[model samples]
Target chain A: MLKVNDINVYYGNIHAIKGVSFEVNEGEIVTLIGANGAGKSTILKTISGLLRSTTGSIEFLGHNISNTPPHKIVSQSLAHVPEGRRIFLQMTVQENLEMGAFTQDGSKLRQDLDDVYKQFPRLNERQRQIAGTLSGGEQQMLAIGRALMSHPKLLMLDEPSMGLAPILVEQIFDIIKALRDNGTTILLVEQNAQMALSIADRAYVLETGKIILSGTGQDLIQSDEIRKAYLGG
Target chain B: MVFLSYLISGISLGSVYAMIALGYTMVYGIAKMLNFAHGDVIMVGGYVSLIAMTSWGLPVWAAVVVAMVACTVLGVVIEGLAYRPLRSAPSLAVLITAIGVSYFLQNSAQLIFSPNPKSYPVIINGSLSLFGGKLTISYISLVTFLVCVIIMIALTLFTSRSKMGKAMRAVSEDKGAAQLMGINVNRTISMTFAIGSALAAVAGVFLCSSYTTLMPTTGSMPGIKAFTAAVFGGIGSIPGAFLGGLLLGIIEAMAKAYISTNISNAIVFAVLIVVLLVRPAGLLGKYVPEKV
Candidate 1:
């Protein structure tokens, strides 16, 4: 479970996330759907300790990780698959997986590798191939598989479907659903509200750094305002 | 026979440059910043080794170890104190800070050692005479060549296989993503400088030994050339550093022998400019297309 309360983040003088608050219960695919510049990525970054919240706090599985460093926050079983699938392009798929286990010794690394490979067999096939050469779908798979390498309690995914073909996007969404079914709590941020809401257990609609609406997946999908605004009628 | 001798000498000088250039390239690959102070760390290593041998009355082996440990500490300290704060600053700010560190080390050495040129001790003495003494190879040159080769092989393995090595490569490509994957970016960078500085100690020893003169500014010229070698061979490639160093060394030797010794340095740099114009990425470096 993760709890974010009234967190405000800034980039120099520009206010980014302004007093935004949200939560994700255990075993829920909690989706944050918003347009560009809605501070979705910034909120995820702040939770992962890549950027600091100027006020308020973030709690993850009982730890007040508000001020923890990014690297340390990772060891706490919270893996963030950053926006744009930032896999180490020069590295092999296997090497990228190994990097996900960076905060750990090799005790469970072999097993974790097996788990990731099982999840994304395309990644296993291209284990030794350079990651940058992977197809958009495979790269997205690599990114998710890499996050799973840490055996994370909470997996935060940002724009997992960005720059992918429609079919690949469906495949990625299916993978996300499968991951949640396997009992990994996912906090997914997406501009693809229709697909996200279809799979999400609960959802929040964000606009201009504020949460404008919250409901169960089906409620938001069928909501008139949501269909008009996010779902494009 | 004359050509062979110059070639042998050239290889020896090239080996030394390769060692120094390794430090330069390794730091660049990981930290994505040029630590101009890297060469000065080598100067400090030379001083430490010289003092350990001449003043502390230590054996050659002990002195070498002392110098390496001292330089390692110095490297880590420099990264922590000088470069760490500028992590988020612009690259130009980091470059200026690196130059500042270089000057700081040089002036500190000048004040401590009085800026006088001192004779470097002969660590590897004697020579091998071959082809009926037509080709004479110094023991130090052989050692330098072997050491350079070993370092190259070891570094290749390190970057490719080891966890820390993997972390370095990851950080080099993308720092933010590396952090997301739980790699300690700061610690990885510090380790890079530490390894680089330790190698600088060895390079300093070999450089001062052949050049035969140790001074506060001794590392500056060789440092520049080795930096040139890194760029010549491709700044981030390990093999590139070795090849660049060797080529630069050979060119310097050939120029000094056949061309004007006074203009040998100029010739080496001129070659670099021409090479850059032809291949901006250096001999082994990849041309990274500009991302708009």
Candidate 2:
């Protein structure tokens, strides 16, 4: 489980995430749905240590890892798949996966690599292909596969569905569900409310850098405001 | 026979420039900072070697070892003290700092070593006749050529195969993402500067030996030439820098033989300009895809 308590993040003078707090339990897909500029990505970045919170605590598996450096955070069993599929474009797909496994050593890397390839067989087929040439869907799969290479306890995905075709988006959502079913805890930040609610166990609605709603995914999906604003009623 | 000798001589000199260029290219690839002080770092290496060999009465090898270690430490410290604080600042700020470091080093050397050109003790002063031409390749020149090639080979292997190298490449591609992956971005950047400075130090020592004279500003000409080589090869491409160095050296030699030495630098710059006009990115540097 991960607990983020009243975190404030600033970019220069602008307060990006204003005292936002959230919790994610074990083996659950928790989606943070928000509009553009709502600081959803900022929250995820702060938790992952790419951007530190001005004042707040992020406890991962009961360890106060708030001040830990970004790279060390991954070794602590938290993997952050960034907003853009920031794959090493020049690198082959296999090399990108190897990079994800940077924090681990010994035989554990081989096992984790095998597991990731098994989860995404498409990656196995094109393992030697340059990552930049991969389609949007394949790149997303590669990013997620890279994160899984770390054997991460909690996988934080920022907009995995971004820029994909409808079919690929559906496939991505399905993979997210399958990952949770296979016992990987996930924190998904998405603007696509309907698909997110359909798969997420718990969901929080964010508006203007604040969490406005939280409930079981099904309950939120059926809510009047959610149906009107996000679900296209 | 003279042409062959010239070509051999060109390649040897080219190799040295290429080695130093690798340092510039590597540091630029990761941090995107030009580190104008990089040249000064090499100059400092020459002085360090001078002091160790002449003042401290150390052996040639011992002098080199001490100079290299000192350069590495200085490189890392500059990265920490000067470049580190300006990380998030504009590239202009970093560029200014680099110039500041260069000036600081030059003046400090003037104060420490004085403005006189001191002869570096001849590590290898003898010459040999080869290929029917009366060629006198200095002992230090051969060593410089061999060392450059060896370092280039080792660097290629390290960047491709080692974990730290992979971390460096990752940072080059995307620093923010690399950090999220749990890489110590700042430390990696520092390591890059250290490696670059150390290589520059070796180049400085050999260069001084070839010229048999050390001045406070000896790094300028070679530094500019090496930077040109890096740009010619492709600013971020390793092998590109090597090819560019060799090409520049050969061209300079040909220009000196057939044309005027005064216009040699002008001709080289003109060639670089033409290359840029044709392909904005250097020969090996590919166009980075615009982030969506």
DockQ list for all candidates: 0.92, 0.78
A1-233 per-residue lDDT for model 2 (tens digits):
99999998898888888888889999999999988999999899898887889888999999998998888999988999999879888788888888898878846877887888888999999889999989999999999998887888899999999999999999999898888888989999999989899888999999877889999999999999999988889
Per-candidate TM equals: 0.99, 0.96
The true-versus-predicted C-alpha distance at residue B179 of model 2, in Å, is 0.9
Collision count of model 1: 0
Weakest lDDT window of 10 consecutive positions for candidate 2 chain A? A106-115
Give a tens-digit lDDT track for model 1, residues A1-233.
Answer: 79999999889998988889889999999999989999899989999999999899899888899999898888999999999898988899999999988887799888889888887889889989999899989999999998888888899999998999999999999998888888899999999999999999999999988889999999999999999988898
For all candidates in order, the CA lDDT equals 0.93, 0.87
The residue pairs in collision within model 2 are A70-B182, A71-B182, A71-B183
**Prediction-by-prediction clash tally:** 0, 3
lDDT of 2 by residue, B106-153 (tens): 899999989899888677757775655476665666787788778878
Clashing pairs in 1: none
Q: Candidate 1: what is its chain A TM-score?
A: 0.98
